[model samples]
Target: MSQMVRRLNDEIESTANMCVRNGKVELLKKVAREFRVEQKSFLEHLEELEDHIYLCFLTINRSRRLVVRLGHTRSPKHQFTLQELNMFYPTSKRIEDPGGT
Candidate 1:
């Protein structure tokens, strides 16, 4: 599963690059369509990395960076470093009985 995600990540990065270089902006949807599965699975990694970054940075710089990209900017190449890396898994869990049923 991880291998698949890595492959997809590569594909996504390459495709995004192509979009910026050749200005093939329309190809994004197709590229994203093919990379959905990996994106969905990569949420945990994204969250963990974000937590680590937050822990590492203890200044106004981090907040400023986030604020700059705080908008519906779909153009991934422009956002670069702080693109809102979305992971499509449910992070919240429900409370239930701890039974071996």
Candidate 2:
């Protein structure tokens, strides 16, 4: 079970790498369309991680990789803060309420 979960994690990481190389938003949408089940499973695995240090390490590493792949962007509009994200972006579960409360 651990092995299978690791493999699935690797697959999701690969997809994420590709997403960073391409347009992250577009590639993520494509993945959601094509690999919805795997995407959900990967998220579930992340949620299951019990160790804060390990989870933070993994999250930071993945975020760094994505940032590096993004290269240096000249446009400031592409960048968003956590506050803006929290204020504006809606989760998949509540996408219907995109207007944000």
Candidate 3:
């Protein structure tokens, strides 16, 4: 697993974001070639490794970046009635088909 992680660190273009660590198909093939494994197997391993690494960073960053609820807020209480939604339709066409049927 350390070897795979090392290989990934070497292969990745950037260290700033996990999006870069998620395997591109071409990149995965290249890693597979290096490991002499079938691309499908290598890709599965890559995904698992990336998930583990990403989760580690997420855990580390969570406390520093955590958002706190600052104030009391309530969900919107207003509900739109059917008539309110009918403003877009022409009032002259009252047959209820709206589709002009």
State model 1's lDDT.
0.60
- Per-residue lDDT, model 2, residue 13, is 85
Error of 2 at 34 (Å): 8.4
Shift in Å, residue 85, candidate 3: 54
Model 2 alpha-carbon miss at residue 81, Å: 74
Off by over 4 Å in 3: 1-37, 65-101
Candidate 3 yields a Cα-based lDDT of 0.56
What overall lDDT goes with each candidate model?
0.60, 0.64, 0.56
Q: Candidate 3 lDDT, tens digit per residue, 11-33?
A: 56353234436745566556547
Give TM-scores for every candidate, taking all chains together and pairing residue i with residue i: 0.28, 0.29, 0.29
Candidate 2 colliding pairs: none
- The best-first sequence of candidates by TM-score reads 3, 2, 1
The residue-by-residue lDDT of candidate 1 on 10-100, one tens digit each, is 9878879989789787787776686586766667787777677676674456655655655445454555331242221123533333463
